[model samples]
Every structure is written in structure tokens, then in C-alpha cells.
Target: MFLNTILNSIIQIIFFAALPFIWWLLSARKRIPFTQWIGLKPWKDRSTHLGVWIAGISAAFTAVGLALLFAFQGTETAVSVFSGRGIQAVPAVAVYAVLNTSFPEELLFRGFLLKRLQAQFGFVAANITQSLLFGLLHGALFLGTAGVGKTVLLVLFTAAIAWFMGYINEQKADGSILPSWIIHAVSNLVSGLCAAYGVL
Candidate 1:
């Protein structure tokens, strides 16, 4: 199971990281630079200012996620993933969740996929498409064991959060993904802590 988990994490990271480039090559005709397309450039403020906002947003996001975890009765499953592992395993898990899960997922869904969809569809459609995709990805993670109802709720909640993230990114004329990425990472950390402590 441990090996399986490691392999799965690695595969997800690779797949998400490479998916944007592959899509750009096959589908995108315009000569958009990858960094610009992915919102790697600066936005309204410095990273320090953005980091402050992200901390607040992430705190709220994580609270909602934790509430949903209990509402969905996902405590058992959530805890099991990191339960028996020693406390020493926590920092590693946190790092993995942020770097492998949150960062890659945001890059794929919000950064790459949203931008690509916006090019074809309008902003509304792009936002909805990305949210749906984001929800579907969460569905894969929470649905199998949680059953349809709870999983659906989780998906919708996540999609709504994604929409908010997208909205925030577009609030300024020049979009930056750093804030969303930070929020995503922080949310995962919060959830991981809850699971580790059996706080659901």
C-alpha cells in the first residue's frame, strides 16, 4: 500500500506537469509563451503582499474543507492515509501534499486548462469548465469510498472553491497564479493536519 501510494503520487505529478505542454502542442495554435499562459508573471502586488492574502484565504478554505469532511463522514478514510505512520512522516506528507498534489493540480486545472479553455470559450465557459474538471478530479479521490451523495457534495464544494479561486485570479488585469497555488497548498496542509489528528 505504501509503495502504491508513492507510485500514485509520482504518476499524478508527472501527468499533471506534462499535460499542459502536450495540450499546447496538439490543440493550441497560438504562439503563447508557457509562462504567460500559465500566469507565472507578476500581478497587482509583490509576492509578500499576495502571500498575506493567501494565508487568510487558505485558512477559510481549510475550515470549509474540514467541515465537509465530517459532513461526509470521511474521517476514517482520511485518517487512515496518514494515521499509523509516525509523526516523523508528517512533514514529508505535508511537503508531498503541497508540492505534488496542490501545486500540480492548480497548474493543470487553473493555470493550463483554464487558460486553454478561455481561448476557445468565453470566460464564463472557461471558468465553468475548469471548475467541473476540478470537481471531477476530487470526485476520483473522494467518491469511490464515500458513496454518491457525499461525494457529490464534496465535488460541488470543491468546484465552487475553484470558481472563487479563478475569480480571484482574474480580479486584477494581469492574473497571477501564486495566490491560488498558495491557498491550495495551505488547504491541503490543513486537511492533512485534521486527518493526522483525527479531528474530523
Candidate 2:
């Protein structure tokens, strides 16, 4: 299980981290700026600053809610999904995961994909599409168990969360991914801790 988890994590990291570069190369034919595809910009507005705090708090509550929901419902699969690894080892892996999982995943799903798709398709369409893809990415975790339904629910829940965060990132109109990053990191950290301690 540990080996499988580690391998899965590595693959996920590589896949997401390479996404921007892959998309950039493909979209380069159309002359789209790399920054636009990567969602890079300067943070010049106060709203972006405010968003950091708001999103952070929202992430905290969201983590708590997810933990409680999984715990009360006796969903062992959901609780154990991301737990086996030791927290002390997280830092070493986190440096890579932060870039690969957090930043690039957000950049690909929320930044490049969501923004570009939204321009071509409306807001609702973009949100739903990206959210579904986000959910599908976790399909492997739900294999061979009744956890599939719970996994889908969790993914949909996360999708809704991502939609809101994506909106904030877009509205900020600045280069700062700080708000969303903070929210994502905190939410994951809290969720992992809770699950590890069996509090979830």
C-alpha cells in the first residue's frame, strides 16, 4: 500500500507539473503568451490581499466539514485516502508536491483550463467541466469499494470549492496565487492531520 501510494503520488506530481509546459508548447502555435497560460501576473490590488485571508478561513472550515462528514458517515475509505504517510516525511515530499500538485494542478485546472475554457464556454460550463475532470482524476482512489460514491461526492464537493476559488483567482486579476495556494495547502494539511489522527 505504501509503495503504491508513493508511486501514485509521484505520478500525480509529474503529470500535473508537466501540464503547463505541455499546454504552452501546444498553444504556442497560436501565439498565446506563456504567462497567460500559466496565469502569471503581479499582485497590485487590495482585493487580492483580502482574498488571501478570506480564502484561508474558508479552507479551514471546509477541511473541518469534510473531516466531520467522513467521520460521522463511517467512511473509512475517505478517511484513509491520503493518510498512511508520516507527517514528518511530508516536508521532503511537500517541496515537490507543492510545485507539482498544488501550484501546477491549480494552474492547469483552475488557471489555464478554467480561464481559457470560460472565455470559449460560459462560466457555468467551464466550472462544471473542470470540476468533473478534477473529480475524475481521483477515480483510482475509489476502485473496488463502496467508496466510489463517497469519492464522487467528495470530488463534487471539492469541485464546488475549486469553482469558488477559481472565481476568486480570476476576479483578482492579479498575478498572485497566494490566496488559493494558502487555502489549498491549509485545507489539505488539516484534512490529512485529521484523518491521520482518526479524528475524521
Candidate 3:
């Protein structure tokens, strides 16, 4: 299971990291605007204070919510959660998660997917579509065909997170993906620490 998780993580990272280049090529060939494809907006003048606060608090809430849920389900022990294993693994997991997980995932899901969907559908529809796919991508955790309840809960939680992130993206003046990326990275880092300690 561990090996499978690692492999899947690697594959997803590679796929998403390459997505921008792939879209660039297609845009060049078809004469589509790259911004339309990738949602690359130059930074606009806007108050970033609210964004920073929302990103921070939302991320904290997400981490706490997930941890509490897992604890309630008895999938993890609280004492071990804050102990040696977590402390040892967090730094490494955080670095890798930021580079490989958060950045690429946001680029692919919020940048690319949201833009493409918005072009075809309206903003609302695009948000919903992206959120749904984001949830499904997390269903990879259910690879073994067992743990149906856990899988379903994860999917639902992922979808909720995606929705919140999408809303954040929409609210930004420049449509920057940075706030969502930060939140996603922090949440993943926390989760990875918890996992390393059998907390989640």
C-alpha cells in the first residue's frame, strides 16, 4: 500500500507538472489564447490582506477538521499524532508536498481545468465541475476496494475543500492561484505529518 501510494503520487505529480506545457502546445497549434487555457492573469491591484487571512484560517480549519474526523473514526491515536514520527517526517513531507503536490495540483485543477470549463460553461458550472473532478482524484485512496466509508468521506471532504479553493480563486482580483496553493500545501503538509505518525 505504501509503495502504491508513492507511485501514484509520483505519477500524478509528473502528469500535472507537464500539463501547462501540453496546453501551451495545443494553444499554439489551435490559436487559442494561453491565458484562456491556463488562466494566467497578471497580478492586479487588490487588497491581499483578506486573501492572506482567508488562506491561513481556511487551511487551519481544514487541517483541524480532517484531524478531528479521523480521530473520531478511531483510525488514528492522538498521542502518537504529536510525537516523534510526526516531528521527524513533517519537514521532508512538507517540502515534497509543496513542490510536487500543491503547486502542480493547483495549476492543473484551478488554473487549467477551471479556465477550460469557464470557456465552455459559465463560472458557476465550471467551479462545480472542477470541484467534482478534484474529489474523484482523491478517490485514488480507495484503490484496494475496501474502506468504502473512508473513501466516501474523503471524497466529500475533498470536494468541499475544492469548492472553497475555487471560491477563493474567483474572488481574487488577478485570479491568482497562490492563495489556494498555499492553503493546499499547508493542509497537505499537516496531513502528511499526521500520516507518518499514524494519526490519519
Candidate with maximal TM-score: 1
Q: What TM-score does structure 1 among the candidates reach?
A: 0.80
Model 1 score (lDDT): 0.73
Model 1 poorest ten-residue lDDT run: 74-83
Alpha carbon lDDT of each predicted model: 0.73, 0.60, 0.66
User: Candidate 2's C-alpha lDDT?
Assistant: 0.60
Candidate 3 clashes: the total is: 0
Give candidate 2 misplaced runs (Cα > 4 Å). 1-11, 29-36, 47-49, 72-87, 90-97, 173-178, 195-198
Clashes of 1: 0
Query: How displaced is residue 148 in candidate 1, in Å?
Result: 2.2
Whichever of 1 and 2 has more TM-score, that candidate is 1
lDDT, candidate 3, 138-168, per-residue tens: 6664534426666676677778788778777
Candidate 1 all-Cα RMSD: 3.2
